[model samples]
Target: MAAEALKSDFGGKAHIALNDPKLRANFRRAMDGLMTKRAAQFADADEWNALRARGAAVRARALAQLPELLERLEARCQANGIQVHWAETTAEANAIVLGILQAAGAKRVIKGKSMVTEEMHLNAHLEAHGIAAVESDLGEYIIQLAGEAPSHIVMPCIHKNKVEIAELFADKIEGQAYTENVDELTAAARKALRGRFADADAGISGVNFAVAETGTLVLIENEGNGRLSTTLPPLHIAVTGIEKVLEKLEDVPPLLSLLPRSATGQPITTYVNMITSPRKAGEKDGPKAVHLVLLDNGRSRVYGDSELSDTLRCIRCAACMNHCPVYTRVGGHTYTFTYPGPIGKILTPQLEGLDCAGDQPHASTLCRACADVCPVQIPIPDLLVRLRTEAVHPSATAGVKGGGSAQSLSESLGWRGYTAMYGSPLIYRVVTRLMGLFGNWVPASAPMLKQWTSVRTKPKFAAKSLHQLAREKGFSHD
Candidate 1:
């Protein structure tokens, strides 16, 4: 899909979502449940901080030596008889996977819950090429039927209510009555998907982590659909970003511990599938042919920048989105990208390029709540500020001049003046008196002054600055 089309669709859907009380309520309930469960899970684990630290360290180490690690991973996978392909961009990645399917003469593909697939819009690509790609994950299948994008990272259809899902199923399934009951919906989805699973020529999935030492592709999921997707078909392909690689096998345990708690608050997912290679002769069930596609897209560029390199450490737990006030109010579509929320604010600009997505960096309130809650302690707020700095730099600003031109210049000057005033008490007093004079010009009830008055009414202009007040009150200047 074109970026403009995706952006327009996202904006329209977001407007509808904003007015949807049912969706809003559902999101609130789901977010609250997940957060409460996560907090409780972490409360008992005294080593949570240490685990987060280790997780961050592991990711950092992997990024520092990503090329070496990827080479090692490819070698190990090749030794185990798994085919690996390297794609420098999205088009190349899609072509590599499509070529594998065509080479196998596969007409049908069953896909698990893979955000990378969503990022690549793989289903649409397959359909455009006359291949049928069935989404096996319950939520993903529902979205595919509805022709909509996933709203949440882990829970793709979090925006849908049970009633909406029931209606969708009833419309899609022959001779089925609409019902909101959970069991009925689940049974309907299962019946619809069983045939696809049995007949699919290939299974495609996303890797949560790729271990260099063992060449293992790790998938963590609650639904077990991922396991089926990787094992049921004769051919299996795992697509993942280059950043998903880890340095050592030992790094997996700490990351595994952090993921479930941070994602859905489960101590462990119902299933964790580790696939090192294709099925061996003794194996009764597993794909006979296995392939791994390491996708770069825009990650390699991010790795070169010091400020953005840390973003490669994200485990995709999406804790930041759950805790983000802006994300909650605006929903995921406002982000206009694959990822959303505070991390998106930083990552999207870097991945998409600041020239195309510079506005994203300024979307945050810089509240730091996301930073506080992040499992890996990524300095998300700090990154956002840096991105904004880059966006408004002289050259960048000159390229995008418009209505905010005067305001931006004024704001820049205001910051410069404030910095100068902070160097001396006398200068600070002069600045405050000037501010007090300006404050007096506006009516107290004016919208511009409302923010200041809401918390405390603007103080009457002082004859002198705080330094004079301190001196008059007999307080030492020191």
Candidate 2:
């Protein structure tokens, strides 16, 4: 499925979860634990701010010379015996991956956690072609068996509780012991996946960063499945967005420094595998063939637009989502896309267009917390405002313009009136006094006032307006 299609389909179901206690508990426990760990990790790193700055600079430099870097990367990879393919769209990317699998005559495929593949819906597409795509990552494996899209970026099954997982394993795994203990369930999954990994004709994974200097692909994961996926199979395929590129090899350390700290609160992930090319002569168990598929899929459009270009700096550490109060309450499913949280809100609109992702920009609280916590310092709140403006005001060339209704006209007029009034204190005092007269009419329990009341009590209106009070106090105002 296309990214927008999947988002639309899943977003509808996320509403049903608002009343689900079990799911809410699952979300709260996992998210809270992860967030606490992340806070501790950041606290330990005294140079966290410095690391973020360096990471941002590296990504900015890479994006500035993306065309040149991609060319250099392609040449280096080819020289190292790794074939490279460019895909301009999701369908083309999926087709390229499937064609490669077909050429290898592969029947079964083992996959590590790769959100790019999820964005392209590569598994479903491959299944339609008679290939069994097995998810090797434990969380991904759980979600795949549940026939659901991932709820979180790094942790796919974050919404599933242990009992639910035990039930899933009981039904799926033949003769497996049914246990809710986390370790037992993980062991069961590992036992099941080990067979698939050994017998699979190919392995598929995602690239965290592709270094142009050495033509190296990096994968960061807590589980060793990423290592297994990249090494064990005879054929290895990596699918990633074009934004994953890094200009020079030295630029990697700062990004690596920031990612794990921001992501899961670890100083570094358990495994950070760097693959330069396919296994050479006398290699001890590595893929014989290696292919890297670089996906554009609307990223180029974002790069061209100055207002939204900062979104391309995302390393997908998912820190914005972790720190977002809105995401913590509503969860990733509410965004209903491959990528979720604050980053997802800005990114989905740019990738899928304003019309397709209408709910995303409005999803934020505009608290600016996400922007403050972002590792790469993408002005997420500012971008969201830009997207909301575009959503509310479609282009005149689109035929159906925005300002057609009486309500919209009134809103525009009200904004203009407020702007003019606020420019002069005399007019502002007049409006303020006028509003004070009607303040008593506003009900304490008004639904429109709930959000304000939730945070603070409504201020008692003064018996006299500021103008009257000033006059009573004998304060002369020209």
Candidate 3:
């Protein structure tokens, strides 16, 4: 959502990110502590693997029948008097939402924590049209007040500690004391958002799982904010990526079990909401009008590829970011995309296309840690490798001339020179002496060498060749 700083230049952004001590420490502590909790949740490797296998099977089957499932879901929702809308892109999704709000004459909206909305960049879109949408989730509200995109999908404000959040609250909300106490801080946030919730003209939320067989929308969260955002306002709007659909209500148990355990190491979240319809005739409370927006936004592209379709298996548990070595060091801001971390590596490229998300796939070390921790068993490392190939060697690109990528002409030329010199013994001898004589004099000013010396000192090549010295000492090739 935040314009990837100097877009598609991962190396440049990573270089700057790698130097942030605070970012590094916060990510390390949070990721490490949460990973420990996750590990504790599954002490039995056998049981854990079994659940993952089950989760993967359920997702594969659901995805295999996605088209049928989606249709069934639409029918079920419509039958319950919930209007369903389909959006092929972010702009289309935003337009659909705005149209609904305008039709209802809604001025103020309160939103539950929905990454799909973030994907659409809906807050800014709404603000541009003079519609005020406020985030109701505690973490989301904090980041929204700070005027920042979520760093972590599951924990939107995971990057901000209690003290930092206290500072933020004291600065933003009027008449609030600067208290670092967690309860006090949460209470302050609750008090601040409570007024907005009651005044909201409409409520918008995201679906964790959509049941096609029964036509239901499922939301899981720790706080009651999700409840307020989806039920309090007269108009309720729900949005989710199309991949969230499941064929049967029975399949939800295994996934529901896996999501919180893998995400926050809890067996079950505090609130598991199932919305079958708007408030019925006898219901005293609930939105009178309800709408569901199914967003494609390149997800169908990912789903269409059999090899990449496994990516859709993600429940947005965000386990990939939790255990990621690259993500932990650089933090989410470095990725400069909505998703960030390993999942972002594969998903961003497909959704945004290779041109806009060109540098994202290479942001990983391909360590396969993400695949190992994934509840649905998405082959993240393999997918990352696949995306990397597509990014660097796009079918239309040859020799990397002018694609607006980090691969420079000088880097390519340097590689060519290295290949030539290393292949020939005579050329190697000539180069080694020239290197020994003047390698240090090559200077940090050299175009190719500057990248290597950006953070560390230049290396000094040895004055004498080991082969020559060995020959003088009468040693053979052995």
Clashes of each: 0, 0, 0
Question: Better model by lDDT, 2 or 3?
Answer: 3
Cα lDDT, all candidates? 0.82, 0.84, 0.87
Worst 10 residues of 1 by lDDT: 397-406
Q: Judge candidate 1 against the unseen true structure and give its global Cα lDDT, from 0 to 1.
A: 0.82
Cα distance off (Å), candidate 1, residue 283:
3.1
Q: Per-residue lDDT of 1-478 in model 1, one digit per residue for the tens? A: 5642443233345568778788778788778887888888788555888888888888889988999999999999999999999998777888999999999999999999888887787887888888999998898999889988887788878878898898999999887789999998898888888889999999999999999999999999988889999999999999999999998889999999999899888999999899998999998989999999999877887777766688889999988888887677667766777788788877777766666566666667899989977888899999887777666662332222121222466567867877899988788777787766675676777764565686587666655667667878999966
Q: Model 2: per-residue lDDT, tens digit, 1-478?
A: 5454543432354567666777778878877888899888778455778878888889999999988999999999999999999999999998999999999999999999999999899999999999999998999999999999998898888888888899999998998878999999988988888999999999999999999999999999988999999999999999999989999989989999889988888999999999998999987889999999999988887787665788999999888887787777667777767788889888887777665665677777799988877889899999888777767675343221121211356567768898999899889888787768887778767764665676588877875786788889999977
Sliding window of 10 residues with minimal summed lDDT for model 3: 395-404
How far off is residue 175 in model 2, in Å?
1.5
- Give the top-scoring candidate (lDDT): 3
C-alpha root-mean-square deviation, each candidate: 4.9, 4.3, 3.4
